[model samples]
Target: MKKWCDNAALLTLHGNTVGMVSKEFVVSAPGKIILHGEHAVVYGKLAVAAALSLRTTLHIKTIHDKDDVLLHLPDIGVEVGWSVPEIAAAVALPVCDPEKPAPPSEELLQKLKTFASIPHDSADTKTLALVSFLYLYCAIVGSQKTLTPLEIRIESKLPVSAGLGSSAAYSVCLAASLLLHKNLISASGKWSEKDLQLINAWAFQAEKVIHGKPSGIDNSVSTYGHAVSFTKGSEPVILSQVPSIRILLVNTKVPRSTKTLVESVKKKYDKSTVVMSAVMDTMEAVAKECLILFEKMYKGKADEYYKQLEELIYINQQQLDIIGVSHIALEKVIQITKANGLCSKLTGAGGGGCAFALIRPDVPKETLDCVIQQLSLEGFDCWETGIGAEGVTLHV
Candidate 1:
C-alpha cells in the first residue's frame, strides 16, 4: 500500500491542459459492529450498530503519464491493472449520476466473472472484491465525460468475513474516492450532508454486489460514522455526539459460514414465525434500552452506567443463543471473560468468528491487562480499540 499523507494536498503542475490532471487525496471509512439485534434487523426490528476504531483506508493518487489504472490491495494479494484505452473500450458505460449511481449490469458482471476466473458461486474474497471495484470504477468514473488515470490502494485494520463490515468499508471508501476523483466532490472544503448521502447510496450498490440482501446498516455506519439506531425501511437515526467507548475485541480465528448461519436462523423463523417475531421484538426493545442508557451513561454516572450496559450486553447474548447463533468457541470466550468480571457477547453472524468484551472505565488497569493476557494465552487475538469514530473523512 502507498504510504498515506495525513494532510494530503492536490498536486498540480505548471499549467492546466487536456488530459493533464494529477491530484492526490485520501478517503477512509470505518467498519462496524452490531451492538444489538443483528439477525432481528432483517425482520424489520431495530438494531444498534457503531463504527469501530478499525477502518479501511483508500489512498488515491492521480497520474498524468500513466497508461493504465493501477489497483492495489496489499491486504488481499491483488495487484492488477488494465491499460486505460483498453479498459474504456471493454467496459460499457451506463448512465450514472455521482449522486445516484446505478449497479452494474448482469451482462457486464458476467463478463467480469469470466475475466477474473471466479465462478458464480465461489466464495473467494479477492475475486468478489475485484468484481465490486471494477463495477464501481466503470459505472462511476467511466460514465463521466473524461476519465483520469489514477492509482487506488486499499488497506484495512479489520478482519474480512468475520462480521466487521470489511466489504462495506471498502465500498464506502471507493465511492468517496471515485466521486472526489471525478471532481463531483471537491477536496477544498468540508463535505456536505448531500455529499455524504451520495456516497452512502453509491456504497449501497457495492453492498448488493457482495451481500445480495444487506440491510444497509453496514454501508450507513461506514459512510456516516458513530452509532445508529437502525431498522428496515426507515432512515437510521444517527448518534453522532455519543461518547467514545473502549472495548476489547477478541478473534477466535475460527471461520464460520455467514450464509449457513443466517439460513439456520431463517429456518427457525419459518418453523415458528409467531414465536420468532416476539423474540425479534424483544431484541429491538433491548437495543432501544441500550441506546437510552448509552446517552445517560455518557452524560454522567460512570459506575452505574457500566453496570447497566453490562446487563444489557449479557441479555442480548442470551437472546442470540436462543436464536441458535452461538458456538462452543464463543461460549468459551464469554465464559473466560465472565470469570474475570467482564461481560461479552458475540458481535456478528455468529457461528464462530469474533466476539468482544466491555471494559468498564472504573476497572483497574491491572485487571484489564490480566483479561487480555488470559485471552491471548488461550490462543485468541485481542485488540484494545474504541468505537464511535468519524466516517469517511478526507485527510485535509
Candidate 2:
C-alpha cells in the first residue's frame, strides 16, 4: 500500500514581540465535464467524466475575537454573517446525522427558502447555494464544538449553470476546509485516502441540499480528481493514470432546462423502446472502448485512438439529436468544428448549454484560430481548458 499523508506546519511566529498568527486554511477542487455521456446515461448507460482544469477555492481564516462568522461568496454575490449563537439556535432545525446526512427537512428547506427570499419549487442559485453552505457549517461546526469568529471566502473560475460541475467543486472545497478547520483531517500534508473519502461523502450531502437526486458523479470526480467511468448501480472506476487533452469548451449562451430535456428523452425512449435500447447499447460500447483507449491514448498509436474517439463523439452527438436534446446553438458549434475539420459534441444535458471540441495534436493553428474566432463571433464563450486535473487539495 502507498501512503498519501504529508505533514504541513502551522502557527508560525514572526515577531520577537509575540503576536498571534491566525490559522489560515485554503482548500480547492476542480470542476468536471462528461466526456462520452449525455442524456443516454440517465437510463443506465455508461458515462466517462474527467476533471476540468478550472477550479473553485475556499479560504477560511480564524479571527481571534468573538465576532460572527462572515461569509463572502463573490462569485454568486452573497456576503453575509451569522453569530455562533444564532447558528446554535438553528439546532432546532432538523439536521441528519453527520455519518449519514439525509436531505434537510422540508420545514428547514422552506425556512431557508423564506429567509433567502426565493420562491417555492424553484431554488435559485444563490438561495440553494447559501442554504447548502449554512447547513454544512452548522451541521459540522455547530454540532461538534463551540463556534469561533471566522471568515470564509469562495471564488471560482468556472462558469456557473453551464454544466461544468461548478456546484460540486464548490461543495468539495467547502467540505475539505471545514473538516480541516475542525481538525477532522490533517491541515498541511498529503491527505489520506480515507480522509478524502470522508470529504467526498460530506460534500455529496451538500449536493443533495442543492439538487434533490444528484447522480454523485460531479462531487465524486471533484473529490477524487482524474478520469472516471461510471454506470448506474456500479461504483465509479477512477483510472490510475489518464491522458491529458486540450478541449475547446464553448457556451452557446442558450439557456435550457435539464428536466425538460430529460423528459424529452424519456418520451422518445417510450415511443421506440427497442430501437432506442440498441442505441443505448451502442453508446455503452463506445464509452467502454474510449475508456480503454484513454488508459494508453497518450502513449503509442495516438492517432488511431483519436480517430476512433472522434467517431464516438459524432455518433453520441447524433444520438443526442435523436433523443431530442440537441439545440440550434449546439448544431452551430458542431458546424463550426466541422468546418475546421475538428470533432465536437454537446457535453451534458443539452438543448443548448455547452459543447466541447477536441483539439487533436494534428490540428493546425490556423484552423484552431479560425474555429475559435467563428464561435466567438456567434456570441459563444469559448475556453481552451485542460482535462484530467488534480482533485481537492489542502493548503496551510
Candidate 3:
C-alpha cells in the first residue's frame, strides 16, 4: 500500500521529536448494527449494517517524562500499565506494519499474554482489551526507538457484548489516535480515503484479537462511518446516499452467545441443506431489495418509500425467526413496537440482544415517548438515535 502522510515539515516536527513534545487529543468511532442479514451472512449472503450514534471515545495523552504506557478503561473498571522497555525487550522483532498490515502472530500474542499476565485460555473483555492495546502500541509506536510514554483512557456509550460493535469502535479509535501520534495520518480536517483504509486495516487486526474471526463489517462501519452493504469475501459498498433514519434501539439485556447462535444455525442448515439454501436465498433477496429501496429513498423521501422499507423489515424478521434466532424478548419487542404503529426487527446475532424499531418522520413525539416508556416498563433499555452517523473522527 502507498504511504499517505501529511507534509514532510509536519512529519519532522512530530515524528522526529516524539518524546520532546507532549500531545493530548481525543478520537471517536461509532458502534454498528446489522440492519439486515444476520445468520445468512455466514452463508455468503449480502448483509447491511450502519454506524450507530452511540460511539466509543478515546482520550490520549503523552507522558513525556515517564517510561510506562498506561491504559484506563472506566467502562470495564480496568486500569493497568506496562513498562515500555519491558515490552520492547519482550518483542525483539517488529509485529505490526501499518503500510503492510497482517494478523497478529501466535508467538507475539502469547508473548503479550505472558507480559500482561493474561491466561492463554482467557477471552474476557478486560483481557482482550489489554492485549489489543499492548499489540497496537507495540506495533504502531514501538518501532520508534524514542517512543513516548502515554496514557489512553476509553469511554464508550455502546454496551459490550450486546451485539453492538463496541469492540470495533474502540479499536478504530486506537488506530486513529496511534497513527496521528506517529504522524502517519493527518490530524486536521477529514481523514483521506487512504488514511481511513489504513486505520480500518489496523482496527480489523485488533478486532481479530477480540472476536477471533470477525466478518469485517463492524470495523468497516466503525472506521468509515455511515452505512455499508457487505457480502462475504468482498469489499464493502458504502451507501453514501442513504439518508439518516431515526429508530428505537431496544436492548433486551438478556445475554446471548454469538458463537452458539451461529452454530445452531449451521446445524439447521446441515440437517436440511435444500430448505436452508432457499431460506438463505430469500434473506439475500431481502437485503438486495432493502438496498434498492434505501437508494431510492434518498432521492424521494416519500411515505411509500418508508412503507416499503417497513415491509422489508417485517419480512426479514420473519425469516430470522424461521432460521430459529429470534427469542421471546425479541418477539415481545416486535409486538410492542407494532402495537405503537412501528416496524421492528432483531439486529445482530439475535437469540436476544437488541432490536430496533423504525420511527417514521410523521410519528408524533408523544407516540414515540410512549413507546419508549412502555418498553422501559417491560425491562428493556431503549435509545432514540439515528443510524448511518459519521464514522471515526478526531476531536480538535
- Measured over all alpha carbons after superposition, the RMSD of each candidate to the real structure, in angstroms, is 3.5, 6.0, 5.6
Task: Give the higher-lDDT candidate: 1 or 2.
Answer: 1
CA shift at 300, candidate 2, in angstroms? 4.0
Taking the tens digit of each residue's C-alpha lDDT, what string does model 3 give over 275-354? 99999998889999988887787788546688888988999999999999999999999998999999999998898899
Model 3 misplaced regions, further than 4 Å: 1-22, 302-304
- Candidate of highest lDDT: 3
| Model 3 lDDT on a 0 to 1 scale | 0.85
lDDT of 2 by residue, 53-140 (tens): 8899777777656567778888877777776676656555335545455566788777656654567677666678778887777666
How many backbone collisions does model 3 have? 1
State in Å the error of residue 243, model 3.
0.5
Judged by TM-score, which candidate is best?
3
| Per-residue alpha-carbon lDDT of candidate 1 for residues 1-396, written as tens digits (9 for 90 to 100) | 333334434422212455333367667889998899888888988899999999898888766666777888888777887666766666665446656777767878777676556697766666787878777887778776445677888999988777888999999999888887776664542678888888898899888777677778889999899988878899898888666889899888888887798899999999999998888888888898988887886788645777888888999898899999998988988998899899999988898889999988877888888988888887888888888889887765
Worst 10 residues of 1 by lDDT: 11-20
Give the distance in Å from residue 146's predicted Cα in candidate 2 to where it truly belongs.
1.3
- Displacement of residue 271 (Cα, Å) in model 1 is 4.5
**Candidate-wise lDDT, in order:** 0.81, 0.79, 0.85
